[model samples]
Each structure stands twice: as structure tokens, then as C-alpha cells.
Target: MVGREGVAVAKWLNSLGFYAFVLVHRFPNSETGAQAPLDDGRRALKIMAESGLAPKGISICGLSSGGHLGAALLSEYPQVWTSPDPEMPQIEFAILGYGPISTNAAGRTIIENKPPLPPKEKQELYDVVQPDVQLRSPAPPVFIVYSNNDPVVPVTNAYRLAEGFTKSGAPVELHIFADAPHGFALDSPKELPVSKWPVMCEAWLKQNNWIE
Candidate 1:
């Protein structure tokens, strides 16, 4: 669903001189199971680290479900089963664009398939994969952008995420536009204030020394 959007963002970030990669992860479904996406993410980061392009630590920017994947990876969920690889690179920062942070709330809906997982199975996955619930100490600095009136993902999810970061003593910047639909991406109309998110994100990156 987000493949083209991911490509667009990567191209824009590249124009800004960032070494970015688009991770087209497998969906959390009956075939691949719940942990599929996050495992792909962790592996992707390991590959990026091996590439030696990110000398100054890596960053993650994800849209929608991809955002949830990034957060879950950062949160290091199912810690017993998913210990960090010895050579895994540090995640310096993250940008989440309208991620569904609460598994019981918005996230479950995203992962629920046509022939949804059995309730017991679903709850077990949710318990260990919630990013807001699992936010750890020294949380990576985050920049979040979402529309207050987003029709698909509740705006409250953004609040929950920011609150998690705050409680973890992590630096977080959140911007909620008064109105916009889900998945506007970089194509938000110029008249809509949501279109300015990229500019705001760039400014935030510069202020945090993530970019010049």
C-alpha cells in the first residue's frame, strides 16, 4: 500500500543528501505471521549498517504501518525472543507519519487480515508488540506528524506515542494539523497546511543536528 509513498519520501530525502532506504516489508498476516514486518526492519537496518553509509548512526522514517514497524523495532519488543544483533547499528532518530501506536486500539486494525487471526492469537501478538507500551529508556529522538482529524488512524494514537516518549524522557516533536485525510503523504495540496510537514520536519532535523 505504501510502496510508492515510501519511494517518494526516499527520493526527497536523497535530494536533501540523506542516505535513505525504502523497506518494503511483508505484512503481518496469516502467512508471514505478526513478527514478519519487524524482523524485516531489523534485518534492513543490519544491511544498512553493513553498507557502511551511515557512519553517524542510522535513522528511520516510516509512513502508516511502516511507522509502526519502525517504532516496534526501536522499542525492541519481544525482547526475550529478539535480542539486538551484536553488530546492529544504533538508531539515532525516527520520524513517524501517522502511525497507529496502540496495538489494542489502532494497530490491531491494521494487522487484522481478511480472515483475521484468532482472538487469542491476536492478543498474544499485541501484548508484546505495542510501541507506546514498550518505549524504553534513552528512546531515540522522534519527530511525529499527523492530522488531528485523520479519518483512518485516530489522532489520539499520536498523543499516546508522544506521551510515551515524554514519560521515557525522550525528546519528541509532534505536529497535528487541524484537518487532513489519511495517507496524504508528500502530495498534500498546497492550500492545506498539512502540506508543510516536510518543511517542518526538515527544520526539526536541522535543529537537532540530524541535518545541516
Candidate 2:
């Protein structure tokens, strides 16, 4: 969260009058592996809810892998919160910036970051952690932005996510720019159309009545 990209995005959101919280979530290489991020994100939402800083409820936003974490929170919330605590804060919406959405992409990324694991264990983990597969009906609204020319995470990830949410009967908006490399964040050149994502996202929030 302390990275330049995160700080830039947070400042931009704050300037727009949104109480943006940059979460420094745990990495997949940690002891809990892939589950570490979900645990941290859930706890962060709980804290934000108790703080009462956002009367309109909290929304999750992330770039690249961070976006995957936010999406996971929405997709896996039901199974993770089996006890059904009424007080548990739910994500009002999600904004994903070039996130890798497929299970193979996620599993491959994790394996690259962490120590080598047995093939069987890796496949099992991949099978269980697919956010697109687990996306159920009545999902929170999602705003996705990506560049078709992104070299890191393919645009297919974005397409698959949009398809998943649409199939699940959730309100979803997707914007695909013709250019812009991966991890563009808020630093995309002004000349590039991808830089308009923040403005478009703000409009989306207003359209959904999340902000005035």
C-alpha cells in the first residue's frame, strides 16, 4: 500500500472526496499462502465498518494482483464467513485494474512467487481458489478496466470476469483500452485513453448512488 502507485491512487480518490483506504494486504508467499490476502482483507473491512468512516459502505479497489484479492473477497465471502455474522461488513462494490482473473493465472502467479510445491498440491490449490468459478448470483457491482495490449495479464482475464458476473446476474461495467502496458495504475500517460479510468470510475460510483 505504501508503493507510489497505491499512494497516487489514494490521493486521487481522496481529492475526489472518497475515503480511500489503501490496504497493505499479506502476500501469497506468507505462511497461509493464497489465503493470507483474504484473511487480511476481511479483517480490514471489519475494522473499516467499526470505524464508521464510510456511511455509504466500503468499496474495494486494487491493481493487478491486489485486484485479484478484492475480487476473491467478493467471490469467497460466503464460504469464508460460514457463521453469517450480520455485523460483517460486505463490499459495496469492486474496482479491478488489470487483474488476472482465471484460476490458472492465479495459481501460476502464486507458484512463481512462492517456493515450489508438489504438482498434486498445486493443482488442488488451483482448483479451489478460482474466483470466477466461485462467483455466485447477486454479486456486488464491479467496475473493471484493462488494456487490450497488456503484456502481463491477458485481456481474456477481464473478459472472463465480466462474463462470470454477467452470468451471475450482477451489474458489471467493463472498459477496455486499445493500448497501455500492464501495471499502468494511475500513471498512464495523459495521451493514452486508459488514463481516463479514474474519471470513468468516479462516474460509475455516482451512477450507482455510491457517491453524490
lDDT of 2 by residue, 100-165 (tens): 666354354422454334454333334455677677467889999988988777787788888878
For candidate 1, report its TM-score. Answer: 0.86
Query: Each model's RMSD to truth, in Å?
Result: 3.6, 4.3
lDDT (CA) per prediction: 0.78, 0.73
- Candidate 1: residue 163 Cα off by (Å): 0.8
lDDT of 1 by residue, 1-212 (tens): 55556989999889888987899877666676666677778888999988989898899898887777778877755754554453446788989988767735433453344233365444445555788868767788999988888766778778888988888778999999999989978988899999999999999989988789
Model 1 scores what on Cα lDDT?
Answer: 0.78
- Candidate 1: lDDT of 124? 44
Which candidate achieves the best lDDT against the true structure? 1
Per-candidate TM vs. native?
A: 0.86, 0.82
